[model samples]
Target: MKKNNTFFYLCTLLITVFLFITFTTIFSYFMLREGNKASAIKEFEVKEQEITLKTRDKLKIRVYRTKTKTIEEMDIEEYIKGVVAAEMPAEFNIEALKAQAVAARTYALAHMESVGGNGCGQINEGDICDTVHCQAYISKEDRFKAWPESKGNEYWSKIEEAVLKTKEEVIVYNNSIAKDIYYFAVSGGKTESSEEVFSQSVPYLQSVESTGEEVAPKFTSSLRYTNANFVKMINSYYPNSITSSSNLKNNIKIKNRTSAGGVKELQIGKTTITGTKFRSIMGLNSTNFSFVFNGNTVEIICKGYGHGVGMSQWGANSLGKNGKDYKYIISHYYKGVQIGKYTEL
Candidate 1:
């Protein structure tokens, strides 16, 4: 009897000890796995910059200007999304980048009707150019097995939060703050005039002005004629900027004039072409310059896309590959002032 009782007690104690050990081992394994996962997230070296707001709120946002990483090397669409997300850094978060992507993509989709050379493709749409006039898009073959953004739970959550917060201003060429946007151009190096800027019209140098600057034409290109949807879309941007097809003149002669804005007045001798002809003869890249003749309105065919503003997109792609950041990229093309944020301005 004594032996039986002792044997039973030993068995129960051993079983209890085994079960305790098993539970502890499983818990330890899980804890270690979670710890490693957290560590891995921390390992990612995402840098950020801080700024003071107009309302005195301080913000810290991640900086995506990777020197060695090209758009091809990284998911460029995601990078751009982050650029516009206007997110300040927080704890273990990658969703803000996607949130910005949705908004940016929305903006792009909405304005896709604009000229090819416009928007994110412009020279200086706020702080981005996509080229020398701006920054750049990711080229082909670089988008390998990468984590691009999507409108998933994480994406939607972040976007909803970002949208509700302060909306980043839609930037335009010449640092123009817009309700939305008027025009965007895919810049090369320096933004040329309409013929150059829109029509890809090469300049014919007439003479060097007294300022030692070669002064030829405010607009050296012909009014780009296009019946394309983008041409028709220009009306929405500059409601006053576009004119009728009657702007086309038969005996049109163009001469450069310096005024509040060059190409201000288009004069065929002295009968100033004030309406659509004014825009046409002056070669100003406005909707008014479009002309209708014999059932076909002369639509100025915009060649290269964009505002022809600051940094060119292609130019930046070349430079970024050659090693440049947002700061170096902007300074190389745009003259004057150092590379610094506009802060509250």
Candidate 2:
């Protein structure tokens, strides 16, 4: 009987050891599975946080204030409102204002690396400046001060409506924001091709006829300067080349003209300067100019204003007044571009 009891005890001990081993293995498997699940959850949270941060950056714009020498960060849409108010005239048609809003929004996005750019850190760690160098921007208070007290509310409401209507809309070419969306006050009967004006070939900025720009206030301007003054001006640009009025008249000639009738190349003594450069130096309204030097006086006739490239604000206003919608206006100026909402960076 004692021998039987000993064998039974041995069997019981063996069963206990096997059960312990099995339980331990099962517990270890479950712990490893739980640990993996926790790791996956943590990774997902990190990805979610990264996306949120990116979205926040994309939604905001950093503006550099030139006067105050400071940086201001604000919502992109709000920034657009300020730009539209400052860039376009308050009396402009609502559709034209909307078009300006879209263009400004596209320009801002194109300059921001977080949104999609090489990064336009123009000033003070900001994406853009509040001057014409980037885009003219006025704060709410300044905008109010710019207009008459009675018209301030009305104009501000009008601009706000336009901006909100075209919120987040941008001009896109080939599934990306257009690199350049240039706009000027007026065109000289025709818009200039980008290659002619900026010396850069942009496929979307081809020359196109823009009528009704004659309605602009300064469509044509005449600058009368004495031969002595003309020579002085030219000499400022090309020093010591033109000593006398007769020398200036003899050396100054148009070497080449663009297809749109704007000056392409001009010869100033020995140096050949671009028509755009000449216009800038002479303070002419546009590159489409003609000069006549008659003995003692020189008179320069300039047509239109600004660079004469891209959309003409005056032309846009005319089209808008004629019942053309903003889409039609933008499409007419920018060739073969899609107006689409930006869904992502």
Candidate 3:
């Protein structure tokens, strides 16, 4: 009987040990599975957050196609790619291309009708137009066609990389994106102040020296017209003011100049007009110009390629080539500004 009891006790002890081991193994397996599930959930959340941030940064814009007279909505990043491709030379430095991309983005955002701003004035149905009146935009196909076949792909890849690297970046002033971030082809050695160019004062659009524009092609242009043709053109616009070429020669004068050396007030026969107006009427390349009337022809010499306001494209390229980054280039031209991500606003 004692031997039988000992056997029963040993069996009971063995069964208890086996049951404990089984329970501990099952518990550990379940804990590991739960831990893995939690880890996966956390990773998924992180990915979702990343996706949300990307979506927020994706800006949409309405573009008006001048050729088709149609309005199409597109991603602002893509629009900026087109604008940078069309506006800046593909051969420009990557930093210069990036600067152009930011300026173009800021300009577009500032003029967005959905943000309580006026459209680009080229169309009623779109926020901006694909012309110089707003921003020059070129389709991918047209851009490729504009370049040499040998260099087209390579150049386009550079522009695309620039645009993507600086994606969602814009210039900001006073806690807001600059609305009138005007830019031009050249500056005639100096940029003009806002008040000097547009008759409206903007603190950020201050006058600044722009070097290296002299190296640009077409930096200087001369328009020469016969005295008779000059008089006819002036009279056609002014109407019955200049009776003869002599009257025009004597009456035409530069009344004053802006601080940046741009023509300010131009005196004509019995009418004084701003240099801005004169540029528009005469189709001059820029307001930074001089005029000389000789015996037979009137020669108008322009120093720059566009209105001497805000950033200069050639100047930016020069700066970039001289080891300046895009941020420095932007801040140099636009006084008292900061570079920030658009989504931050």
Candidate 4:
């Protein structure tokens, strides 16, 4: 009888063990499937790209990701001929493009979760739609394969070098590792400070004295309009002078308005103007803003693109199209800078 009971117990134990294994397997399979689905949604890369690290002001500059996947869809032969024909100087040998692809891939891998210019994690699409820090994808026509003709290049080796450290440096920028070396874009050929205008800092950047060119100093009213936002900007530098609740008739007036090309003509009170001169007055640049016009009210509009300082994006693209490489293009606008390996940092 005892022997029979032992056999019965053994059978029950084996059956329970087998059932447990079956249940666990099913659960694990479903869990893995869900995990893969999430990755497919959140993970993507710039096909065949490399990256470098840079620091500015107190902030570490994040690798600028192209929202347009120019690599994945590129037809090397056609792309090469298009660039060469445009009289834009580009070296399109199979080897060179392969190198670019390697570099691009390296950079993309390095920047998977890197920090941004604002000392925050790298932002994706829709984060800074109109801002220059992140490039926006204008259309589906944006995709271009990096190197379908050739595999890749030598630069891929360097992609991983500065990425991790570069991310670390960005945190420092947010915490004030480097003093902020902020600048105004063109200053509209001449410029002044909110401190000068309103006797305060206005939370804005410093202007580089005047360049005297009609297109030299780029000033923007991109973030400031109306009575409330204007007050915040003024108060950012000269808080005592501006009040957020004040209306136009009580504390604001349009002064010395000037108009510029290919932009909307705006009339608020007595003056007519174009460009970002309005932002300079209001103390915003691609970041924060507020505007209240008439009883109906209108939101602030950006007059000029970018920070409005030394170089313009459209200007750089034009130069690139007219025979300029990355180095020449970057240096022309930045002035007196070295594009060295980030490893030195």
Query: Each model's TM-score?
Result: 0.30, 0.81, 0.81, 0.28
State the lDDT of candidate 3 residue by residue for 222-308, as single tens digits: 898887887788788888667777645787889999988889998877678898888888888888889887888889999988888
**Candidate 4 off by > 4 Å:** 1-119, 122-250, 254-303, 318-325, 342-345
lDDT, model 4: 0.35
Per-residue lDDT tens digits for candidate 2, residues 113-202, read: 566554455664778888888788999899998799999999999999999998777887776678799898888889999998888999
List lDDT for all candidates, in order: 0.34, 0.84, 0.85, 0.35
Where does model 1 exceed 4 Å of error? 1-54, 58-184, 192-250, 257-265, 268-299, 341-345
The number of the candidate with the highest lDDT is: 3
Rank by TM-score (best first): 3, 2, 1, 4
Q: Rank the candidates by lDDT, best first.
A: 3, 2, 4, 1
Off by over 4 Å in 3: 1-58
Among all windows of 10 consecutive residues in model 2, the one with the lowest summed lDDT is 45-54
RMSD to native for every prediction?
A: 21.9, 18.2, 15.5, 21.7
lDDT digits (tens) for residues 1-345 of candidate 1: 999999999999999999999999999999999999887764331111112123113222212233433222222234443433332221113332222332343233223222122333332222233332222233222321122434234543553454334233222222321112112223312343334223332222111111111121222234534433323444443343335434435523344432112332344322443333344433454321333333344434222333443333344434544555433443344332121111331
Report the C-alpha displacement of residue 327, candidate 1, in angstroms: 2.4
The lDDT, on a scale of 0 to 1, for candidate 1 is 0.34
Runs of candidate 2 with Cα error greater than 4 angstroms are: 1-54, 121-124
Clashes of each: 51, 0, 0, 41
